[model samples]
Target: MAEVRDGYKITELGEIPLEWDVVQQGDISVFYNGRAYKQTEFKNSGTPIIRIQNLTGIKEPVYSDLILEEQKYANPGDLLYAWSATFGPYIWNGPRSIFHYHIWRIEINEKILDKLFYYYRLDFVSRELQGKKNGFSFVHITKSLMESHKIALPPLKEQQKIAEILSSVDTQIEQTEQLIEKTKELKKGLMQQLLTKGIGHTEFKQSELGEIPVTWGVASFEELGVFFKGKGIAKKDLSELGEPCILYGQLYTTYKEVIKEIVYRTDIKVKNPVIGYANDLLIPSSGETAIDIATSAALMVDCVLIGGDINLFRPNQSIDSRFVSFQLNSTRKEDLAKLAQGSSVYHLYAPSLSGFKILIAPLEEQQKIASILSTVDAEIASYEQEKAKYEELKKGLMQQLLTGKIRVKVDA
Candidate 1:
């Protein structure tokens, strides 16, 4: 059972326990900011340099950039936190590395508290630091603010036990993520086999889409459905709550997934509006030169009614929407490149997409292919949900154990 005690309390984060002491972050740990190093001084190879961008986790640091001899350095086991753009503290787990000026290095006295325990405590208070900002703009965390931030601390032994328990949960999460990736790769291989060649003992013949079965025919997208472009809804008209809308600009890199909760436009005209019914397909007609064009197309799984910045394709009963969606997504890179236009901002126009050719099996075969792929999609979704649950469980454990509300036994 957890009993709550109070002094000056934190909002939404709850009250401190009677046995725990509430102290400034500076009292618990030492904080030092890194020095700025010139970009010209950065070398191709010397040592892995940590930067604000590289600060990801307290135990796991992702090193994407390198630095040369002329940079300030921090060693492994030191906690690094970003103070600009995004504010969250992370421990350095990489090899001997240097950091940019925007990052702060935290050194602790082990006799006072376990370093890992302080890491978890910092994680809990990260949101509080972020909440003090004025708006979406960059808010720099002052050294005084960092030092004055309060936290609940327990005895040193209990702190070590708490860190170990939380670390174990993180390990399990990482393993599960790897398993999910392997499963996805297996499904992709299966799709290539079944989709390219018909099931066992099937006849094949020459067609416009290559040597496909006699039952399969080549068809144009315009022949099967009405293709239209979405309206341009301005950013100012967006609202927190409104009808769900799909924006071509917001299409994901996977092209198969739909990202919701983007800026929504309520004042935009709703007529036709590129509203997608179940099984309807949508494609992007334009994009920047740097982006992959194929990733801008998608098929609607659920009924969504809103229109903004997407090219909608409503399939008739003659063809299966899922089949067309898969074919569009699987289009060869060279074919998409051929259709791409405009040097400044590359675009695959609606007319070009309508004219593009696709290989189509019989209606029954198309449905069967879609059914098989849908099962794989469901499995992927299940894994993602499980991953989310594990994350939430880990967060709860961190809150409890780090504060000594729940204690774990440590091996001596």
Candidate 2:
């Protein structure tokens, strides 16, 4: 007994505009599965085979000398869907290549539906299905099940308008992401130069670490700071509204070189909780890889709870915490990585870090270097925020326009 609006009607998908039609995915498009390849067929160079990893850009592309049917090859502008491992619609923007069996080359009936609009529709449907999966990390939709899925569609003109609007927002998001990456690259280059060469330094000297500015000196971490380990708290100890907390894993996944804010909290009452201090540097004590354990962030807020598997470094008055963080991430990353030990899970203990040495410039120069890097960090943060907003806007627009909740003007 759902109430329908004046110009809206109830369908299997709840309620949509009266003019919209609910149709099976197969009715409007043909999903051609890509060809499978044997390991022996793989070559060093040939036509690139698109796999689920390629869609996500997580793995290097594998090439094959084996030729496939024309329908198996996806060209630029063709809509593609990854059905296994990862799920989603991707309009192939890469060069014409053979797509793996796990992917589907969607051939839309453009006469009845716009390809880009259907692309967005497929994406929306995938999200909805994923939402209903109940905590599962991933769910694979069989070809028959995917084709049988029902979706509500608007008129061709309305579909085109919705696609155009969403595409514009996507473009904004992509451009902003590109800007963030470029700014980060600039920051990386700056750190490499400033941390080693020092600003306005012409003279250089060689130390156990490497060649550095003459004025700069190397100092063991133990001499610059006192180390302590966070104890007791675990991921299960976290809560939404409680004391702000920092977990060791967050150093690699959440915070940057400088922690401007805290995002997690815990309500669990622990006797004498390990509290963080301003200018205190934090690094993970354990991680999946040695390099990951080497990541560090300078805590700016005081009195926050420091969780277990973390190494907290309280710098002396002479040291710039931010400068030390940037140096650890750039110059001493490998040196610290070499010290990390374990079989499957890497561990970085205070004893290992006690004698770990790093470049130390004059206090003034350290602050100056930190300030320059901080400015770039701020720029990257702003761009990331902009990209997030654009992505959110796109989500809202898709929820409305794709469901006919919001209508756009169409040409007469």
Candidate 3:
């Protein structure tokens, strides 16, 4: 690694060129806090209210009757900082909305700094804070702590240059992600065609799952498999090691469609613990949402302990478990959702799921379909690696360019 350049000096914010200044965050921008908006104040049509959840995911802004001055509202492309319960910096890209109490609308003196540069720097700080968050699900990042941290400020021209260099890498990542999504879509289409019609088939047969090749057959969960329920263990009972166990939450969050490797285990011992069989389809019986309850994965290992709220299906007939696992997650997702019942805490009954329709192909054809999809997955994995490479490069450049350890030339 290159040592700090000759013109740079050591400072609280680390090495920077002599021309740059180390300034506290408070001195540069105002962290204007947002007001508390009441739930009853929500309306059908009014000024849109932006909550932390909306900024984080697919949530759309809710309309609010409460109105604030233009300065209090954030428009598209504004920098937003969330301090409590998921602290991070977000570049607001949606329509105008009122910022919630936990968020701040940062107002910077444009002449003294580059806004995009500050956004990236604060984001870097947030990531560092993640390790220090301890076991808390939510940790508040205080204004006092933020205001005390030092930031290295360069000339306005150089700040812009650094932002440009980093932003270019971000653009490349975005384009690669788009390609990955398109490839995944192509794979999905191929699955729908290949899994049903299959290759080199002439005769067709109509079933509950629509027309499939004559060689293909239709089977219910009960006809092809058996359902087994596991005993429940409290969250406190979980440990890093003892005996390998599968958790329902892990099914929703961690496991792949066809899970060949088990990562979680139970520290507690139970009398006659239910053991999962090889090639068993594992589904979470309880979840917060319908889509979550629809989550399923296949266990490739046998004799592993299964925890409560997990539904396991062990196929009796000769079949490819990987192909069935992919089928349930893709084509049968909607069918399972229709079987799911409830407003919250969506539930999937084992019996109801047992009767669910499943398309079956010859064992050889099933293996072929699984093999093709696996190849596409490998391609997506390669693109993910490319994305990671650019991201790591960007992180290194940010540490160097933001502090002027490596200086950027400004146009005359």
Which 10 successive residues of model 2 have the least lDDT summed?
132-141
lDDT of 1 by residue, 1-412 (tens): 4534442233234564455677788887777767676666666666555766566534333332544443256787777778887777777777887777788788888888787777777777776555555522356767777787777777677777788888788788887788789878866776666556655636788776567666777878777778777775544556667665565665644336333223344545565555566656676666676245654434554545434546677777767776666665554344655787777877777788788777777788878887787777778778888888889999888767765556566566
The C-alpha TM-scores of every prediction are 0.75, 0.95, 0.78
- Expressed as tens digits, the lDDT of each residue in 341-403 for candidate 2 is 998999999999999998899999999999999999999989999999999999999999999
* Candidate 1: pairs in clash: 58-91
Model 1's alpha-carbon lDDT is 0.67
In candidate 2, which residue pairs clash? none
What lDDT does candidate 1 reach at residue 174?
Answer: 85
Task: After superposing candidate 1 on the true structure, give the runs of residues whose Cα lies further than 4 Å from its correct spot.
Answer: 1-15, 55-71, 133-139, 191-218, 231-275, 286-293, 296-306, 316-318, 330-334, 337-347, 400-412
Q: What is the lDDT of candidate 2?
A: 0.90
Model 3 poorest 10 in a row by lDDT: 129-138
Question: lDDT for every model?
Answer: 0.67, 0.90, 0.83
Lowest lDDT 10-mer window, candidate 1?
A: 254-263
* Residue 149 displacement in candidate 1 (angstroms): 2.5
Instruction: Write the number of the candidate with greater lDDT, choosing between 1 and 2.
Output: 2
